[model samples]
Every structure is written in C-alpha cells, then in structure tokens.
Target: MDLDEARKLWHPEPGWLNTASYGLPAEPTWTALQEALAQWRVGRNAIELWNESAERSRAAFARLVGVPAGDVAIGSTVSQLLAPVAAALPPGARVVVPEVEFISNLFPWLAQAERGVEVRTVPLEKLVDAIDDGTDLVAFSLVQSADGRIAPYDEIVAAARAHGALVSVDATQGCGWLPFDARRADAVVVGAYKWLTAPRGVALGYLAPGLRDRMRPDAAGWFAGGDPNGSYYGPPLRLADDARRFDISPAWFCYVGAAPALELVAEIGVPAIRDHDVALANRFLDGLGRPPGESAIVTVDVPGAEEKLERAGVRAAVRAGRVRASFHVYSSEEDVDLALNALAG
Candidate 1:
C-alpha cells in the first residue's frame, strides 16, 4: 500500500502530531460516524441503536483480533468492563497485577479488597512469580503507558493458567498499534480513543467463550437481559449468555464516531501499523542514543520519578520536548527526525 495515501486515510488532521500518545483513525472512522448519526436521528430507541452498533463494532474488533464476534462486548471504558470481572472473583482470593499498571487497571481490583479479595502488587518482572496456586486472578496491561514496555502476554497467560488463575489484559495502549492473539486471554478490554483513532467514551471488551457467563455484570441494565424487543418481563435477570452481558448503552454519537476510525485501522492491518510504530519508536530510541528520560520524555531518576514527571506538566508539555511525536499510521520518518533533532539540540 502507498504509505502516503494510506496515511491520508488514517489521519484526520495534518500537522497535529501525536508521538507522546497514539492517534485515532481518520477518514473511514469519520464516515462511519456520519452513517451512525444519520441512523440514530430516525427516532430509534437509544438501547436498540447502541446494541445494533455494538454488534457491528464487535464483529470488526473480533476480526481485528482473530476472535469470535460472540466474544465481544461494547463498553464505555476499560474500567467498566473490568468492574464485573473484579466483582466475580472468589472472596479472599488473591488478585495479582504489575506495580506500574495504568489507574484504570489498578483501581478496580483495589476496590475488590473491600469484598475480602487480596490485591497484590508485583514488579513487572515478577508478575509471573506472583501467579501461584493461591492466585485467583491476574491482570496487567499489554503495554505500559508510561515507558511503553510491551509485556510478554502469552507467557503471562500460560503462567496464570498453570496456577488455575484467570487472566485479564488491558489492551488500551496496544490494541490498534499491536497485534493481539485473543485466544490467549480469558478476557481483554480496550478503550478506542488512544490507538484506534476513535472518539473517547468508546471501548470494547472480549470475553472468552463460556467465560462471559462467569463474570457478574457490575453495570447490568435492562439491555443486558438479552431482550432487544424492549420487553423487560423476564424472571430475575440473568446476564446475557454472550459478551453482551457487559453492555451498557453507550452514547450513540460516540459509537458512530468511532466506527470509521476502527474501519480505517482494519483496512490498513494491525501488523502493518505495528511495524510502522515500532520503526518510529526505534528511530526515536536510536536518536536518543540511550534509553529515554535523558533527552526525551523529560524524565529523571528520582524517587517517584514517574509521578514527578506527570506533576511537572508532562502531558501538556509533551509536544515541546525532545519526544514530541505521536503514534499514528500517518506519522512520518520526517516527523521522527524532527523530534530527534529537537532532542539532540
């Protein structure tokens, strides 16, 4: 594929570079949004419209990650899907997670401590070590948002399974930029804004077959009862048999806005996108001539170094630093060079 043409379709705006974070998909997603909005204006019930969009979105996500559509659920955020998984854990069972996981992955399990569940923080290197027979659940991010370290997911999943533990992955940072093997995870959750080039307030969750029924829906609503017919006359509600069990009617406009973005990604292929990102990251790394934190990212070696960086106004100043580029299909070698040159100065 022509990189430039492909980029044009993948990026919505020119010169608004995004190296510190990933950019959403551009043209195709915008088109999908318009179509979804038009459909919504016809006075369709919000729940019905969301569920219909959810079906299409799920199918697209399943195809991207190589899973069955039945395993996918539309969610508003990663935390929303994870809340149920945390709620369903056996009382007093230990949940293991990396020490530096994003807040979305950390707080939900910590909340479970009130229910007698034990939350254990293990170093990234010791995540596998923390998973033993006593561990009932293990959760981690596929890519650490701070340093951008991609975890060895297959190994982690295998270790968790050996200990009779279920595994959940937060793919928010990695989903659109990296290729994921869904069969290796018990469940995977992602927010579309970061890498999929979609609008915020849109996300997807995938529950392995048979595992959907195991999760207690923390945000269960009438729609989750599986009656798209608008009839709520069912016995004390059971979560839907499919991943829809996690569905809460999300904002229809946001869902519509996200569709084109994901479709653009689908067209380009994730592996191609991953290759593009890795290449760009390599360029940034090589230009720094050492690990990040020295020339780029403005990080320092201090106690709570990461926390200090955030407090120092990193996100706002991200574009002014040596590492001022963003990750997107349209990001260019020239952009990488410019970031490197700024850091070299």
Candidate 2:
C-alpha cells in the first residue's frame, strides 16, 4: 500500500509520529460518525439501527483481531471489561501479571488481592516463567505502552496452557499496528481510541469459547442479554449464553466511527501494515545506530526529548528520560529522518 494513500485519510500535519498515544481518525470514520449523529438529530436512528451498527462494529473488530464475532463483547473501556473478568475468577485463585505493564492491565488483577487471590507481579522478562501449576490466570499487555517492548506472549500462552491457567491480554497498544490472534488467550481486551483509530469510549473484549462457557458474566446489564426489542428494560434479567453476556451499552456514535476504522485496517490488510510499520521503526533505529526492539515504537534516552521532537514537527511521548517515536501506516521516511536528526542534535 502507498503510505501517501493512508496519510490522506487523516488531517495530521506532515510528520506526525504519535500513533501510540492518539490516532488521527480517517476521513471516512469521521463521516460515519457525523452520519450517525445526523440520523439521531432527524429522529431516523431507532434502537434497531443502533443495534445493527453495534453488531457490525463487533464483527469488524473480530475480523481485525482474528476472533469469531460470537466471542466478541462490547465495552467502553479496558478497565470496565477487565474488572468483571477479574471478579469472575474463583476466590483465592492465583493470578500473575507483569511488573511493568500499563496500569490499566495491572490494577484490576491487583484489586483481586482483597479476595485472597495471589497476584504475582514479576518483571516482563520473567512473566512467562511466573505461571505455574497454581496460577489460575495470567494477564499482560501485548506491547508495553511505556517502552513499546513486545511481550513474549507465545511463550506465556504455552506456559499457561501447560499449567491449565487462563490468559488475558491488554491489546490496546498493539492491536492495529501489530498482527496477532486474540483467540490465543482466554480473553483479550482493547480500548479502541489509540491504534484502532476510532473515537474514545469504545472497547472490545474477546472471550474464548471455553472461558466464556466456564465464567459467568459479572457485569450483567439488559443489553448483555440481547433483547429483541432493543429495550433496556428487563424485570428478570437474563444473560446471553455467548460473549455478548459480558457487554455493556456502548456509545452508539462511537460504534458508528469504529466500524469504518476497522474497515480501513481490513482494506489495507494487517500483515502489510505490520510490515510497513516495522520497516519504518527499523529505519528510525538504524538512523540512530541503535538495535531494533520488537514493535513499531522505538525509544531512546535523550535530554529535553519532548521539546526536541516538537521542534522537529514530530509528535511523540517522552517519558522516563526517553523519547519514544511510534510509527503506523501513516508514518513516512520524512518523519523518521526528522526524529532521528532532532534526537541526535
């Protein structure tokens, strides 16, 4: 795919490289959101319309993440989805997580400690070995949000499988730029604002068939049960037999935007996008004369890092005394050159 073609979809000034923090939504996504809002204003958007939109959005997400549409649950945030998944575990169960994971992925499991659940916090390097026979669940981010270090999820998944432990992944940081199967884990949760290139307040959770069957929904609402009239009224609440049982009411407008975002990803194809992003990241690394890390984000220690990037007309995050330049389909050779030169100076 021509990078210029992808770049035309967003309104970023030339050389924006901060997709890891916030994505510039494609023009079509914006159009979809506006069209939904127009329908709402004109009284043309019935609950049925919104429900159909939700299903389409869910299916699009399933396609992007390599999961069956039936296994996908809709939520508004990672924390919203993670809490119930954590609560559903048996009391006093043992759970393991990485010490340096994004806090959204860490705190929910940590909260399980009040129930006498053993939460083992290990460094990323030791996360795979941390799972043992006693572990009931193992949760970690696919890509570390801070340093962009990709987790060795295959090893962790293998370890979890050997020990009969369930696995959950916080895939928000890696979902769009990196390709992987969400079904590999028992559950994978994502907030769509970042790399998914959608509006905020839309999140996705995928529950494997076995895990969905074994764990009951902890956050049951009327929508989770899939009522035909699309009514939010249920006297005796009945939950869904599938992953929809865990879903919460979504922002309808957000779903409108999200569907198109996934469509763009599917059109360009994830494997190609991954190759493009990794290549851009590698170029940045090579320009800096540094070794490549696992994913599209490349970080280097620098003084006044954020200001340097800003002066170079690049957008990135500088944290922990390191400058992190993240690439996506829209990033180009010019962006990397500017970032490398600014960092070097």
TM-score of each: 0.83, 0.94
Residues 277-320 of candidate 1: C-alpha lDDT, one tens digit per residue: 77765666667564542111122123342343344332312321
Q: For each candidate, what is the lDDT? A: 0.71, 0.84
Worst 10-residue lDDT window for candidate 1 reads 293-302
**Which is the leading candidate under lDDT?**
2
RMSD of each: 4.9, 1.9
Clashing pairs in 1: 18-325, 18-326, 19-325, 19-326, 24-197, 25-197, 28-260, 29-260, 29-261, 33-256
lDDT of 2 by residue, 136-161 (tens): 99999999888898999899999999
Query: Which 10-residue span in candidate 2 carries the lowest summed lDDT?
Result: 226-235
Clashes of 1: 10
Candidate 2 Cα outliers beyond 4 Å, as residue runs: 1-4, 42-47, 228-231
